[model samples]
Target: MKSSEAIYREALAQLQRLIEQATAQGVEEAHAAALATADRYAHPSVRMVYIVAVEEAGLLFFANTESGKGQQLIDNPRASLCFFWRELQEQVTLEGDVIRQSVETSDNYWRKRPRETQLAAWVLPQGTPAPEKGESRRQVRQLEQALGFEPVPRSPNWCAFRLQPERIEFWPSGWPRMRERVRYLKQADGLWSEALLSP
Candidate 1:
């Protein structure tokens, strides 16, 4: 049997390859994943978010701290994510504990965003209700006028979160009656273990 570390590396490599394949096939939002989070009460919420990077620790995504998902994550740090590429008939699911990245890391990502996006982040209150239509658009316009070509600073509420997955499963389908599923689970000692599940 392969060591836990080997299985862990294999899983990461497999995910990266799938991402590359999806991009090559011109799949729209190839990096997007459905992220699921729950509040303190265990009510679940799920939405699509772009997985910008596949790091050693896990997957990284950015969002506003004040957003519904963000608030839920704060209240309950456990989360899950599902990535499916219909074009390739492949899916990956991850379950993990979420953690906010360092402020400096968030700032770095913010600096790379387009100026318009930065301005929108400044004016848009992510999880709040807007009674008036185009209110956020109006605010963005006003903010743009005020900034007047000045660099838009990153909002403190906007940051990146990483999902350090304790469990990850990969499923690929093509062969007839040959569906297979592989799962990797992180052990308490920080290593990973691999299992094959009936599909």
Candidate 2:
């Protein structure tokens, strides 16, 4: 039998490989796991899900910047994210504090949106009462007419928010009902110390 240290080293190696593969594929790919789990669970909370982008001091969530959710982040910057991929049999849980996106960063992402979507930024009040559909459509049409061929302007509300992760836990479900769990705590120096937990 291998020594406990040897087994741990092997597990750590495998975990590193998986992380590298997931990162190379991008967060969107990681999000696929989240989508699959969300589909299976049919959770309403997952409807507007996003990968938690974290800094040392804040949490971030991104929307059209015109959506009510964006305003909520601006007002209250706390969030928790749960991600699961059934095929891979893995899950990640994250909780953190958030901050509003900087104007320059918001503008950068805003420019990438389609013109119609950019215009929609102005039509929505974000986190407020829903506007009448007919009235909203009319306003959009009017804006289109007024703007003619010019590019749509970014609303002051359009932006991204940043989230700082305080705690992160990774759970990998094993076959035959066995499972493995690891928890990481971020240090002041930005390093993480991981601990294994009983499954």
Candidate 3:
């Protein structure tokens, strides 16, 4: 049997290859994923978030600290993510403890965003109800005027969250019902190990 560390390295390489291919093919949502988070009581909440960064270290995504999932993440730092490449018939699921990124990291991503997005982030109060009807559109207009072409600042509460994965699973479809799952788990020695799980 191959050592877990060896298998993990191989799988990560395969994953990076898949992501690169999907991106190159002009896939609309190649960088999107379903992120699952739980609250203090262990109740789960799942939502889709754009995948900001993918690397050997782990995944990085940004969210407002006041959003529903963000609040949940604050209460319970454990979370998971699922990335599916439908055309390629492949899926990667990752789970780990969530930690806020440094101020510099969040600012870096913020600067990359469009002016509209940055302004919207400022005007939009996540997880809160707003006035009904055209209130949303009106708010956008107000936000645009407020910024007046100036640089949109990144919110301190809207920093990036990094997931240092403890588990990484790749599920690729096979003929009929013969599905396969390959998992990489972090060992106590601070290295990742791998195993196959029954579907």
Shift of residue 57 alpha carbon in model 1, Å: 1.5
Question: Residue 21, candidate 2: how far off, in angstroms?
Answer: 6.8
Please give, for residues 84-189, the per-residue lDDT of candidate 1 as tens digits: 9999999999999999999998988889988888987877668776638888788899989998978888899998999998999997765663788899999899
Q: After the best TM-score superposition of candidate 1, give how far the Cα of residue 67 lies from its true spot, in angstroms.
A: 1.1
Question: How many clashing residue pairs, candidate 3?
Answer: 0
The whole-model C-alpha lDDT of candidate 1 against the native structure comes to 0.89
Ranking 2 against 3 by lDDT, winner: 3
lDDT of 2 by residue, 1-199 (tens): 5653444344345544554566665634553322111112233233345543333344344664444455445455565566555556677766566567688877777787788877777886566677876988888899999999987877876667665555667788667657878776665765556678886
After superposition, the stretches of candidate 1 with alpha carbons farther than 4 Å from their true spots are 173-177
> What Cα-based lDDT does every candidate model obtain?
0.89, 0.59, 0.83
Candidate 1 has what TM-score? 0.92
Ten-residue region with minimum lDDT total, candidate 3: 172-181
Residue-level lDDT tens digits of model 3 in 15-120: 7787888888877788889999999998898999997877666788998999998898888988999989877778899889998888999999999998778777
lDDT of candidate 2?
Answer: 0.59
How many Å off is the CA of 165 in candidate 1? 1.0
